[model samples]
Structures are given as C-alpha cells and as structure tokens.
Target: MFFQAGASMVENQNADAILLAGTDLGLAFDGHDPGYRVIDALALHVAALTDLATSGRG
Candidate 1:
C-alpha cells in the first residue's frame, strides 16, 4: 500500500513518470499499475547490461 499510495501521489502531482529506484520494489509493482508511467530502475539496469553483453563491444 505504501508504494501504491506514493505512486498515486506522484501521479496526482502530474509526474511524467514514477521511478522505482529500489531493487526490491519489484515486489510491490511487478504486475501492478499505479495508473501512470513507472520506470523500474533495476529492470532498466538489467536490460542495459544484457544489451551490452550481447553487443560485443568490449
């Protein structure tokens, strides 16, 4: 409920996107929506790392 309420509050304030910066926040938002754009930092980090690994640019 804490995460949901915070996200809703941010959305109410007209935020373009709510960032979930904590890695453990997935527990609160994995399959949930707070009626706004939510960017999960951990997910993005993982995606970037995966892309870099596959890009072979080392």
Candidate 2:
C-alpha cells in the first residue's frame, strides 16, 4: 500500500525519494523495501547526531 502511494507520488512529481516525518514511522519501513526510496526524517536526524558524537564535534 505504501509503495503504491509512493510510486504514484514519484511518478506524478518526478521525486527522487519519499520523505517520512514523525519519529515512530520508521517501523513501517523496517526490514522491508517499499519498492522506492523512502527516507525517515527522524532517522536522518539521529544519524547526524550519532556522527557528530563520534566525530567529537560540538
């Protein structure tokens, strides 16, 4: 279902990827591919934090 919707949006808008806001929505894409690119905003934020932490850059 998610894939279909995303596909439609991609086709209609020529989008390269899908943006998913909200912190808890990662569960939907976990261990599964939606047949297109779907980026979880929360995950990207966390990953940026993790990288900063590891790099010792405040």
Candidate 3:
C-alpha cells in the first residue's frame, strides 16, 4: 500500500528514488522493483563498514 502510494508520488513529483530505512521494509521491497530506484540504507552501511574495515589493513 505504502509502496504503491510512494511510487505514485515519485512519478507525480518526478523524484529520482526512494530510500528504505526501515528494518521491515525488506519484507516489502526485497526482490521488488516498485517502479523506481530503491536505496537500501542497511546495505550501504554494511558496504561502507566493510570498506572501512579493509582500507588500512594492508
């Protein structure tokens, strides 16, 4: 329901993407396209942490 409404707003407002910051959002958005770009904050955070952990470790 929210994704559908959000997608509509995205199209109407010409927005570029949606950011999924809720933990349970995965249940709704995983493997779902939602007709727009979806940014998973947890994935980005994990990736950044991985990079930081490996950066200065030789």
Candidate 4:
C-alpha cells in the first residue's frame, strides 16, 4: 500500500497508501512528509483495527 502523490503519470487512478522502505530515508523521515492529515488518518485506522482485534472481530 504505497501512496505516492506525484509518482504516477496516469490521470484516472491514484494510490491509497504507501509502504516506504526503512533504508530509503531512515526512520526519522518516516511519515514526516505526509503531515498531519495522513498521520490522523493512519491513527484512526489503527485505532479501529485495534478495537476490532480486541473484540475478536478482526
């Protein structure tokens, strides 16, 4: 699930997420460029997954 906002040259589709390699830019740069919206979305998704996992519905 790798989302690159500008990497695609197509005009009709887009990526939903991105999985960058640790060796590409190190952990310090992880998600830093995505800013708060991306972080918040990820947090919400994580929280929902956690809830589902804890409830044995995942």
Judged by lDDT, which candidate is best?
Answer: 2
TM-score of 1: 0.76
Q: Model 4: number of clashes?
A: 5
lDDT of 1 by residue, 1-58 (tens): 7566667777678667778799887668888766777889999999999999999974
Q: In terms of TM-score, which candidate is stronger, 1 or 2?
A: 1
Question: lDDT of each prediction vs. the true structure?
Answer: 0.79, 0.84, 0.81, 0.45
Better of 1 and 4 by lDDT: 1
Q: Which parts of model 4 have CA positions greater than 4 angstroms off?
A: 1-39
Q: After superposition, how far is residue 39 of candidate 3 from its true place, in Å?
A: 0.8
lDDT of 4 by residue, 1-58 (tens): 2333423412235444443433443344454664312334444556899999999887
Where model 3 places Cα greater than 4 Å from the true spot, the runs are none
Tell me the lDDT of candidate 2. 0.84
Worst 10 residues of 3 by lDDT: 19-28
* Backbone clash numbers for all candidates listed: 0, 0, 0, 5
RMSD of candidates 1 onward, in order = 1.9, 1.7, 2.2, 6.9
Over the stretch 1-58, how does candidate 3's per-residue lDDT look in tens digits? 9688779879898778887787677567888778788888878888888998899863
Off by over 4 Å in 1: none
Better of 1 and 2 by lDDT: 2
Better of 2 and 3 by TM-score: 3
